[model samples]
Target: ATQGVEENIQEVVGHITEGVCRPLKVRIEQVIVAEPGAVLLYKISNLLKFYHHTISGIFGNSATTLLTTIEEMHLLSKKKYFFNSLSLHASKLMDKVELPPPDLGPSSALNQTLMLLREVLASHDSSVVPLDARQADFVQVLSCVLDPLLQMCTVSASNLGTADMATFMVNSLYMMKTTLALFEFTDRRLEMLQFQIEAHLDTLINEQASYVLTRTGLSYIYNTVQQHKPEQGPLANLPNLDSVALKAAMVQFDRYLSAPDNLLMPQLNFLLSATVK
Candidate 1:
């Protein structure tokens, strides 16, 4: 019955070349698409090839641009993850897709880069390439791209409050995990860089975890105090949390958790709840 429409669709073999006229062949499959506002679904025989194309595109043929875009993406992801807990459409898909080892693209720049490297290693491009040469390029790319992102994330990790630290940690963790792959290069400088990032991650995690727990607990207490006593007086005999300080602290909490940091709660709480949950 649907044969007529099926005939209009496409399924076929495809071929291509790159990095010195090397031929790469692929099998294309039936594509389903919608128009205006639409969704696309495909079952492809060469998903890895598609990933190859995506990586090439994301790189934009320039290392500098790739670095900028990656940092921006990670920052945005961090803000979204920490501030907003809502499950977006893309996240739902991520939940369903099984990523290979290193499981990149949890919205970190390094994650995406590692994923691309994985695909590159599998692709025909890697067939004729020398691992040593490729490894050298990898080190340069990491130094140029990964280093600055780490610096910025480190500053944020150290300077930001509990909520922002949470954002930074999630981002840094993904970056560090992917970055460790660069250890494939055994240069002393690269090794030192790796150790530094590792230490940063460890220190950042401990500090931020402590920060979040303390703040969350305080939030609980504040909510309880406000709920029990909304009057303009000392609710708990805690001088630091007297009316003015309580109001200030509540404001700060809400501000920190606003917008993308909505991971904590959908909205601000007027009463300090009995718990940080």
Candidate 2:
């Protein structure tokens, strides 16, 4: 029965991608290559649903077995070929076509797809099943890919002019943060990951650190920093600081730093402090 359900879901998704997404992509191509019109907003919406459902179905199974299977697959000599083929096929299907509307704006489809992919790919519960060396290595590789993308998404969200797009971007960042927190890793890797996340979020929120915070909730901190800093001499030469937010995020993260828990905070703090000096 489960197999039947999974197959049916896959069929529906295939139909949507072929019947709806393909035509929409062609229409979007015309819009991008020619004059502007209403880009296929309906198609974009349906495509999002199709991808979401497909990913969810695949991940609905046990996470531990899924992660194990992925590891086994990766260990195979042909793993690169499999990975590259999957990536290429997805790229070809999605294409780089833009929407016809000059301002339909950035679709959250990619971000959503990535989030679902991670969820489906992650182990079910690391607390119960301790990671072997091979699993640890796999985690590192996945982190390498995800970390930079998370930073880019955070920056993109901040720069998005429209309120709706900005909100979607922020939600995506939050989801990414929560997902990273769930993965089991060494203290150092976890700390580095957290720092990357907080640093980006801080840039979005800290007033003295980011001009982008001008209209954001974090602008208040920037205002406070500007008011308190000396106007000239040594203080003037020093960088603008939002000690409050920085301290808060660090303290919150410290709670997770412990033995057998991935000593990420102390190491990250050491590197960052060294760079500052």
Clash count of each predicted structure: 12, 6
Which residue runs of candidate 1 sit more than 4 Å off their true CA positions?
1-114, 117-127, 151-159, 162-167, 170-174, 179-183, 186-194, 201-277
RMSD versus native structure for model 1: 20.4
Which lDDT value does model 1 have at 232? 54
Q: Write the per-residue lDDT of candidate 2 for residues 134-177, one digit (tens) a residue.
A: 35544644554455454445444554444333333434444554
For candidate 1, write residues 152-193 as lDDT tens digits.
445434554544444344444444444454445535544565
Which candidate leads in lDDT? 2
Give model 1's clash tally.
12
Clashing pairs in 2: 186-262, 187-262, 187-263, 187-264, 191-264, 207-222
